[model samples]
Target: MPDLITPTTRLYRAWLDAHAEWGPGTHEDGFGLTSTDDVGSRAGFASWVRRLGDESARTTCRWIIEDRQVLGGIALRHHLDEYVRWAGHVGFGVRPSARGRGLAGWALGRMLDHARLLGIEQLLLVCAADNMASATTIQRQGGVLEGIRDTPLGPARRYWITLTPPIG
Candidate 1:
């Protein structure tokens, strides 16, 4: 895979707009909004991109698939305390048009590499109980289920994926 990660830029705004429309289905009430655009407005997204640029947090990265379009993105939120208990180290969303193309697994594998670079020995990944796809992605990356939690949104499954030292 070519560099799936890139700095978020104006060039990606159109892709972001399209990603925003991939919402949760009626049966899956716990999936949350499927797109980051729903989390904020255009300006907010821009601001988020800026924050992600900060080296200290290394907060964001865009994942482009074979087409070189922003197929998805992974957000790494650092400096968590209580939130870490339930919140995962990374949050990800694959564009609606690009779902089920194995991008989530690919992007997650890249994120794990990035997390290792950031000195994170372990990672927490949370997914809605009903989101079998998300759970599979985490499992494919070697995540171990920790437990489940009841959030205001609904019940979420928490998994921990540890980065093991290379064997000689």
Candidate 2:
């Protein structure tokens, strides 16, 4: 199993390549990366990395890696942001070339274990309604769909993974 680690600028090039393979406009907020250059790719991403431990921000970003190859990004947001309550406790993306290999399902299952240890009783996740691949990944990890909900980004599928079982 690949370990989720603190972003190291050393892996920036490999990370860039992996994401680039995912194609343009695939950037997500939790990605913690931007176009690579001598400019601010290192500086900006380094700044983002510095905030991973900020409890008040309620967000954490980590890269999934094994054998020094960057596979993808996975993040866990401890609490819902103001825009959408059911948005997600987690968000993840795998390299386009790395898709369809169960990478997402594996990453999610790892994040769920992390969430449970943190006492996150009910974890929510949302995916664009048109993203069939993501929907499949979520279901594979035991996400129970709660129907689709409207958002600023248009309709999104909402799912909740119960972290702690009900009182027995």
Candidate 3:
């Protein structure tokens, strides 16, 4: 079974293995990684992890792990900024090898619970226009289409998921 976990340096080797599988670049969404983040060295990785912890007030980052391996990641930003406006409140990615297992939607559902705890009544999720898989996942979670908008990365499909109060 896959478990959603907070970022920790204790899983350094496991994370490196997963990062290696991703090849290169900061395309690993949901990880809060940046082009300038140096995750190659031990100190660097630890620092990066610490920075994520420091941002816990504004963002929640979690990794999907099964059998001690990192399968993917998901992040929920608590507020809207310019980047959040384009990228939406949530960002996520499943490693190439872990595609097709419904991990994205599963993780997303958990994150929606988190959003509710934070009093976020609604969420905005945007995916590339060509990414049918992501679009489907969002829709499955009750996402309603809000149309597409052009972004620096290209045309993106925007969706909104309204949260209802938890049933007693």
Candidate 4:
């Protein structure tokens, strides 16, 4: 089973391996990595991890780990902002090697539980319109389509998932 963990410098090597597999881009959606984050050096990685820790009030970022290997990442934003409006309240990505094992669905379910704890009654998620796998994953979790919108990244499907309170 894969577990979600807070980003830490101790997993630097593992994280780098995953990052490299994504092959040079700022599009690793769930990791909260920006173009400016320098994660290439030890000090830089430590600082990056600290920054993620500092952003706890506004967001929750978790790494998907299995057997001590970084498999992917998932993030949930606590509140809406301009970026969140475009990117959605939640985002996730699984490494290429980890794609077919249902990890995204698992991570998303976990994040929805976290959202409920934070009092967020619903969440918005967007994915490239052609991403059938992601659309299917969200649909499996009760996501309702809200139509596709053309954005800087091209047409993207928007979905909303309402959270039902846990049973006693």
Candidate 5:
């Protein structure tokens, strides 16, 4: 694990390159990593990541890197608020160019490994009802559909991943 997550990390820079600088009429970038200037510099990101999972802290985020390159990222949120209740525990994104290669599923499995370490028993993952890709990824990670809920963001489906103990 990284001692700290920073914008200076190759993963952060690669993520910024993957989804930064949106044009008109485009969908809002989902990763929320677009803030890369002085107003949202690497230093600030370091600070933000340092506080994740503190007492009652909402979330903890991490990048998926292999062979010194960032393939994607995953976040495990502790609980829900009015803003996040529908979304549940896990959220993730892979680079657009890296899609369709099963990286998201692999990355999610890796996230599950860490989630178990975090004492997460029943992990909830949510994606937009229309996001079949994410839904499939979650399903492959042993997710079972719990229900769907309407939210300010839209309709979202939540799946639960029950963490099982490793074979001794």
Candidate 6:
């Protein structure tokens, strides 16, 4: 798997910028939509690393796909029961130069593996009702559509994926 996942670091600045400029589309936007310009700075990126390292409360992780020479990332923001109900265990994005290569789907599958390790039984993945690609991705991961909700962005569809007992 080429260690397809890792912590976000200063070394990833170039990768981050590439994906950042790609911006948002589909029924969703970029993966790090909540991040500020400061968060994209070196110092700010360091702070983000520290927060993700907490491993308690809400844990976050950013993983890059190494096999493909593509700017892609997956982010898991834990404690979804609080700030997010429509969102799920993770959100991810693949740069415009890398779309249609199955990188998002691959990254999402890896995120689910990590979620299972964290003892998450079910994951809620939310996408814009018009995001066929995202909905297809979630469904490919065994997700079942729960319903839809009106949000500031637009109407979002919620899908739930149940992890098996083994969870491996």
Q: Which candidate is the best by TM-score?
A: 3
* TM-score for predicted model 5 compared with the true structure: 0.72
- Write down the TM-score of every candidate: 0.75, 0.82, 0.97, 0.96, 0.72, 0.79
lDDT of 6 by residue, 16-124 (tens): 5565567532222333434343455678667655665664356555555555443566667666675468566677766676678777787788778878777778888
The CA lDDT at 1 in model 1 is 53
- Full-model lDDT for every candidate: 0.64, 0.73, 0.94, 0.91, 0.63, 0.66
Error of 5 at 157 (Å): 1.0
Instruction: Tell me which of candidates 4 and 6 scores higher on TM-score.
Output: 4
lDDT of 4 by residue, 1-168 (tens): 889999988899999999999988668879998888888889988988999999999999999999889999999999878887778999999999989999999999999999988889888999999999999989988899999998789999999999987655
Instruction: Evaluate model 4: give its lDDT.
Output: 0.91
Give the alpha carbon lDDT tens digit for every residue of 1-168 in model 2: 677876667786787677667666546434644454221367855555555545425666777787788888888888766633855778888877767878778888878887776677887888999999989988888889999988877899998778763343
Please list all clashing residue pairs in model 6, or write none if there are none: 88-124
Q: Give each prediction's root-mean-square deviation over alpha carbons.
A: 4.7, 3.5, 0.9, 1.0, 4.6, 3.4
Candidate 6 off by > 4 Å: 1-3, 23-37, 55-57, 67-70
> Can you write out model 5's per-residue Cα lDDT over 85-152, one digit (the tens) per residue?
56577778776666798877876787688677767788878888999999999999999998887766
Off by over 4 Å in 5: 1-12, 21-58, 66-69, 79-84
Clashing pairs counted in every model: 0, 0, 0, 0, 0, 1
Q: In model 2, which runs have C-alpha deviations exceeding 4 angstroms?
A: 24-26, 29-40, 53-57, 84-86, 165-168
Off by over 4 Å in 1: 1-3, 23-45, 55-58, 65-68, 166-168
In candidate 3, what are the lDDT values of residues 1-168, reduced to their tens digit?
Answer: 999999989888988888899999898888999988899999999999999999999999999999988999999999978888999999999998999999999999999999998989989999999999999999999999999999999999999999987656
Model 5, position 98: C-alpha lDDT score? 64
